[model samples]
Target: MSLLLAAPILIPLTAAVLCVLAWRHRTLQRGISIAGAAGLLASAVALFQQVSASGPVASQMGNWPAPFGITLVADTLACIMLLINGFLAVCIVLFSLGGIGQRREAGGYHALVHGMLAAVSGAFVTGDIFNLYVWFEVMLMASFVLMTLGGQRGQLEGATKYVTLSLISSMLFLSGVGVLYAVTGTLNMADLAVKFAAVENSALAVSLGLLFFVSFGIKAAVFPMFFWLPASYQTPPPVIAALFAGLLSKVGIYAIIRTFTLIFSHEPQMVYTIMLAVSGLTMVIGVFGAAVQTEIRRILAFHSVSQIGYMLMGLAVTGAAVADGLPGGSVAAGASASASTSAVNAAIPEFAVMALAGTVLFLVHHAIVKTNLFLVGGIVLKLRGTTVLARLGDLYLTRPWLAVLFMVTAMSLAGVPVATGFWAKLVLVRAGLAGGEWIIVAAALGTGVLTLYSMTKIWSEAFWKVTPDAADLAAAGQHPTDEAIDAADIGPRGVPIMMTVVAVMAVATVALGVLAGPCYRVAERAARELLEPQAYIRAVLGPTAGRPASASEPAPAAASAGGVPSQR
Candidate 1:
């Protein structure tokens, strides 16, 4: 069981080391990268199956007990995330083989890719807050290197902004950890949860919670904090951008969900209200931003922010249910009641479950679809030689299959019927209406309309319009770079490697949409575990994990306490 839990992190780290060692041999490095990705995928699948059959799984390093040693855990949510990461790693590695230019490959690109994968896997599985912080740093370091690999002017500029913002987020996270430790004196998340519940200082706890909220909000690319994403994501290679779009921000969302649900399950009213307001603003701003962008990758980057709003909506609903004393648990003590609270409380559990399940469903569906869309953009760049909409056209005539693939993924993104995104949106909208969250429902619907509009703009400019000649491009003050010209001259033989990887993802997107039932069942189970985290708590800290300290009782000393020590 421990091996299964460790496999996802270990495989990637080992592969990264091997890739670095074989850096002088590009062929060996490439082979190692492929093998590592495949190994990760296999390990993730096994872990998911084991967790499914036998509740949540946990392992303490060096045979040490919980709260005293490093711990790795795999609840349903973590397993689902690991599975997605594994799949993306494979597709992105293959895509990079064909899409990343030779200059970047020679600069330890494969090694960096594996390192990032290791960090992502570690983040998903670790049970300690400080361990999560370490993994975030690892991910940030690898991504910074990858972003600046080619040293192009645009790449360097983007990396500077990315690194600057990311470092700030890391510092805030560490500071939050410090403050939280002062209040609770534990770095283990399960242990912290018990201690936080017993703390007497409401103001201090709330302040620390907000600190985490701000730190993760920046990483999740929530509205008002998402400007850095659009400015920088478009500048990286499309494969890197796709991976970032699909996985990076989602990790932040994962952290938000985990902390809110498992650790800060108390004080639902404040948490839910904040999440709801931020989600609405995020959706509105992201779609509006996408509407105005002409570059393909930039538009997609903005859409990533919008999609995050939907996931956050699910989380907000979950918080509301808890506040209303729904099926998952009770409202926090001293929570003030309002006149309409009774009415809202009447329909809590059903809608809350729907919202959470919808979020999981949407998360998986969007990751596959969004990643495919970016890969398609890379294909466009490969054939048309640039991503500027006005400078390129007529892809439908030249490559109808690519156009069809784009239409499928784009429509799926827009939540068109029979597409996976449509069902995801439907569930959330229904949940919102059921809970009387009219503003959220309206924001969701409005965002979908604008998303379709943006997709149509891309379709019209890049596929329907005639391809601009060199003279026309020069007239418009748009000169294709020498690399772009060379890319355009390449024929069908140049596309097969990239095309195969994209086709697989496209098929998976359709499969998820067409076969939503089975996937929703899995998501439903994951949501159940999230909403009621006893299984997760026990897995990390043993059966006695939930025992809280009495108000008059002092906490156990840190060195002697078993699992989570109670608050003093």
Candidate 2:
């Protein structure tokens, strides 16, 4: 079972190698990509089941002991993430069949997509902080290339902004890692959790933790740090935009959740307060940003920032719950207060688990629904030649099914009933109320209303009232300027493969909404593992890894399917 931990990363990586080898043969590369995606999905299913049955598991490379070697660990959290990642891989690969043009395919786009997946999976499973950093670099390298592919003016501009922000994030992350190693002499997360309990320099330790928060904040595109996202994400083709929207920011968010719950709770009152402020502002600013955008992808880009704020809200609530419920409120305290502080370390507060579980659900729902929206946007671009709302008018008449699909995902995004987003928000809101976070809860509700308005903007302007074909675009648009929009330069093109892939994803969103119980259970279980890290520690280190940090020391505290881009 420990071997299955590596499958997610290895499968896509092998496929990427094969794709590069067959670069001269597009058909072979295509078949190889599809097969690889399918295989990853299969592996994810098996791994998820195994984790569910046996609890968390870890494997050390070269059979080295804990804190001494490379480690791959999979708890419920890792497996659930892998499951979603594999599912999105399959969807994005299939969509690329008709959505991407031959020129891009010949440019090793399949290879690049697989490479990106490999990096993402590596990030999900790695047991060391430094290993996580390496995966981030791998992801940056692949995504930067993907963004700049073909070197179009917009693509180059967007890639530049993307790389600029990403490099800064990398520097901050590396600097934090240096501080951590200098202080703790270890980089393994489980080991760090143990040692962090014993560190006496609360100020320096928290400063190190804050450093990571800022780094991940920048990466996650939280408010103030998020300006680059709409500017760049909108520049990619809708397919590429969808992939980034679904996965990249979520990884940043994932990092934030991981570090805060596991290694940064010593000063929770201060940390979570600052975080709550950031989350509230992120939601407000992101929704307003989307409201000002007329392009489909740009609007979605801004909303991505808004949705991320909600994830942080859940994190804040979870942090508060964990800190308050654990007697003495810090790992240092837990270490000194008990004879068997390991039991205290292993315990998870009920409230913290519920809140984080809600966060996990939101993360899953957001990835799928957001990716589905981007694919719908791509279909509109393929058929209409542009995403400008004023230039589009009659898609509802021309493609009723496309309109329905858009409504399905858009409704889900706005948290309408019978959609996964609705349930996710409900859980978060409930958790927030339980934790007495009334202000942030109010902010979240207001953001949902604004989110609906933004989605409505897209529906009314681009989808509800426009011609979907080249022949009628000139006569049907919102302005005489629409005549100058050049129908022939774009659409009325067929997107059967694209539509088919989208329909399947659409069904998935609805199914997730209707059958949300099993998912909720899985999410709650994952949250438990995160808050109670003893299982993870034991898995990576050994059966006795959960022993107290030292004879005199305190106890320790406990702890995306986004797609590839398409070219048209």
Per-residue alpha-carbon lDDT of model 2 for 212-322, expressed as tens digits?
988999888998899889878876667777778888888898888878756665554667788889999999999999999888888999999999999988888888766
Residue 130 lDDT in candidate 1: 97
lDDT of 1 by residue, 187-218 (tens): 88867766676665666666777788888888
- Which residue pairs show backbone clashes in model 1? none
lDDT by candidate, in order shown: 0.82, 0.80
User: After superposition, which runs of candidate 1 have C-alpha atoms over 4 Å from their true positions?
Assistant: 326-331, 334-348, 479-493, 548-568
